[model samples]
Target: MLSRLSPRTWLLAAAVCAVLAAGTSLVYGGARVQPASWPQARPEPIALGRPPALPWPSHGQAAVAVAGQAGTLRVYGKQRPVPIASVTKVMTALVILRDHPPGGPSIRVDRQAAIESGNRDESTVAITEGQSFTERQLLELMLIPSGNNAARLLARWDAGSEEAFVGRMNTTAAKLGMKNTTYTGASGYEPTTVSTAVDQLKLARQAMKDPVLRDIVATARTTIPGVKGEIVNSNKLLALPGVVGLKTGTSTPAGGALLWAAHPTSGDRDRLILGVVLRQGEPGDALEDRKKAAFVASRRLIVAAQRSGWAKTR
Candidate 1:
């Protein structure tokens, strides 16, 4: 009966068989189609631009200021105020130093400062109420270890309240030409407290000018009497060669950031770099990388200076 069909019927049967074959193939083949050679896909290429007159600022909100005997490089990030984390303590120490130069009567830790200890997850010097440390030691605690208790203690000692002390911080920043900087608290835990990298570079440059500030930040280990034992500078860069003085900051909102300065031993010139990464995925590692990158970049600036006869290479 199949062989006896007319031409039109045969054509119809052929079409039906074709449809059935296609359906069978689809049912047995599964949804995924395997490609030949695994199909190497090319990613869209990024076009390179002329490198900026300066090295590109580290990714994210960053500003850099490098001035050695060689020359100077300044760059600004998007002008948005962002929390600076413990970098605020740099200004705190500056105001403290400005109000009470290194060698005055020592300030004793009070209850207010002690109360902040181990709270808010802030870094501390473990200062106990009634413990007495020199203003110099406290400054080390504030800048080196980023001691929150030390900041509160200094604020209490200087202005009788952290609030009033923050006022002084803003005032001091304004005096130093940090137009975009503002301080809500000396501890820098408040997200509302913010500053720009450009502003931080100004404060860092000024802080580096102070011999006392320079000495405090350069010290890798300091002995501050704690409730139990001694506290030390937590800044790792202190041990790194060519690093003179600087600060590090981190918070949930601020991510990891650093303001750094380096001067070659042989050269009278120095380079300053401010790096900030907001909302980084891994803050601790990110900060270390930023520091290492800053060191390399600053060293490059120093070498450039030497090549230009701006600095002498020993």
Candidate 2:
């Protein structure tokens, strides 16, 4: 009977048989298979144009860029690498976190770190020798107060020596495409440790990505258990409307340097703005005065960025 069937009938019967066989296999397997889901396409990022004019600082190299975006909107002054002062701590924090995360092991304050704390010429947190602090607390001491001693302690704890840690800083900078950056010391005390505003902005973006570092930078003030008083953030820009966490650097050669982050709302989107201002004020200016200049320049640039529609939403 099968052999005598018409060709069309035979084809239809074969198709039916195939379907029945598939169903039978599924039944035996005790499950019915559903088609795999196709991934939904992601929305394209919004493209933004640089404004015709921004309040670029007259005396320094500065650049403003959106986080996750390549390149910057506008840059001012010479792009050559210049001393970045304590802004070098951003990389120090970043490298330390990369090795030992926020909740990692506690570190003891060595004699050198404790001795360095008494140096009035550089920023320091009063932590005694043999006193132990968690990685997170050390970061707060280093970043919030801009403590040179705390930064070096973190470097030594992480890499056994400041030299080795600085090597890692430069390696990480190179990996992040900060081509003009160089790290000669864990603390930005050495005038030889240098970078451009654009390069520091790149570091700012990376630094803000770590949740611990992000929180530490945004904190206005905090007190450690053994510390004498509250440690206040050095980045005065944090008081600004949209300004958040970042680092500040000031020295004779570095002048005043700031790697800053802000989240300003444009339309319905909260945009992350990362900026770097370097070499604000004359090298001969006092450290506090120079740092104030960086803060002023940063504030102007941030406000201008919003007014000029630099932070756009799709």
Candidate 3:
């Protein structure tokens, strides 16, 4: 029978046997034959690190996210978004700066801006109507004093109206991956304006990158061209060593909050841990008491991250 078969038949049978052998080897758990030159993959290196825990607020809610070379080390809280008050200005400032990269354009403070400052109970630099300020000066007044009016003027001038500016604020927040945040106005005066500490950290990191904003926030105090009485940053924490500028927020519903950026753990000036502490105490606390609560809570977070291996030594 083998001799009767043609050469083509023999070749076909040989091919079928080879295929069957390969299939059987595959099904029967035979070792796969790798190429002689096949390269082996090395295991990824693991850093010996532990997640950070808390000494967080016992009264009001607070959340923190610590970032190192490996990315966000960990986060704490209900992780729920809450009212963020004037910390809202950080978004206001970021949107304006992004739209106007050449920031020296002049802004004519309108009567409404002055009225908003004087009539409302929020922070302000009291920019007067018809008073012209260079963009940088405006930024100085707004960021340093935690000025609600300055934020309004900037939003209106940059986007042609306050509503439009706020629209831009929400849009910018969305782009920053702050899905849990919302901005209803230029200043975070309204209780409806809110965010989580985790969301705010994203905004904080992006905001710190702008040289103009970076310079403005890091300043403990400075005199603007037209403003009387030296413009001091409301963030007294700036006076603390390694403490730098970001912003602070307060309101009846929001309690006291702060967004902070600085090198607390590692002495490296270039590496900074961005921290967000929101609603640090009962809503009805006195203004100074609320502020203290926020400050103390944030400081504890920084200390926790630093000692718990989130911070690298300088």
TM-score for each prediction? 0.69, 0.82, 0.80
Q: lDDT by residue for model 3 over 147-234, one digit each (tens)?
A: 8888888888888888999889999889989999989988888888989888888888789888988888999988877778888888
Better of 2 and 3 by lDDT: 2
lDDT of 1 by residue, 231-268 (tens): 55555655655666677777766766666666544434
**Consecutive 10-residue window with the lowest summed lDDT within model 2:** 20-29
Q: What's the count of clashing pairs in each model shown?
A: 0, 0, 0
Order of candidates by TM-score, top first?
2, 3, 1
What are the Cα lDDT values of the candidates? Answer: 0.66, 0.84, 0.78
Candidate 2 per-residue C-alpha lDDT over 1-314 given as tens digits, one digit per residue, 9 for 90 to 100 = 67899999989778756765554432335767543334446765656645536688878799888776555456888899899999999999999989986666679999999999899988888889999998899999999989999999999999999999989999999999999989999889999998998788778878888889899999999899888877888888788877887888889888888888887646323668888889998767887888889888988888877665666653
Which residue pairs show collisions in model 1?
none
Off by over 4 Å in 2: 1-52, 70-72
Lowest-scoring 10 consecutive residues by lDDT in candidate 3?
31-40
